[model samples]
Target: MIYKVFYQEAKDSTPRREQTRALYLDIDAQTELEGRIIARQLVEEHTAYNIEFIELLSENHLEYEKTHADFSITEF
Candidate 1:
């Protein structure tokens, strides 16, 4: 299953308060719990702040379509 995790980070000066910047990650896992765990681990390793929210966007099909769009070139 593929999950889209949405997370918000805090500012350097204020760790408690959230900053304007946000991160969106697409993760593959068997379950929602696993996805959340992966998201937490990624945030811990990569970012200084904790994740504010973690959600499952879609199961499998839609995620791929959204991430990889179909494109074509037409000669004029």
Candidate 2:
């Protein structure tokens, strides 16, 4: 499944809504808890951002993407 991992610059202060950043990962996990743990490790290996939250791709995620046209996934 795909996970949207919210994060922000580790060296910067906590950001406001507009300043938040995100990265997408395809995690092969079953539950939210499991996905979260995998998401953290993936982020750590690829970036220096402090994780804010991890969102699994479900019904709500699809709606969010529709509403925010700029939402994207990076293929590595």
lDDT of 1 by residue, 1-75 (tens): 434334446434543433433445566677889877987787777666645666565546455646664412111
- lDDT assessment of candidate 2: 0.77
Model 1 spans with C-alpha error above 4 angstroms = 1-8, 11-20, 59-76
RMSD of each: 9.1, 2.3
Best by TM-score: 2
- In Å, residue 26's CA in model 1 sits off its true spot by 2.2
How does model 1 fare in lDDT? 0.55
TM-score of each model, in listed order = 0.52, 0.73
lDDT of each: 0.55, 0.77
Candidate 2, residue 22: CA error in Å?
Answer: 1.7
Point to the candidate with the largest lDDT. 2
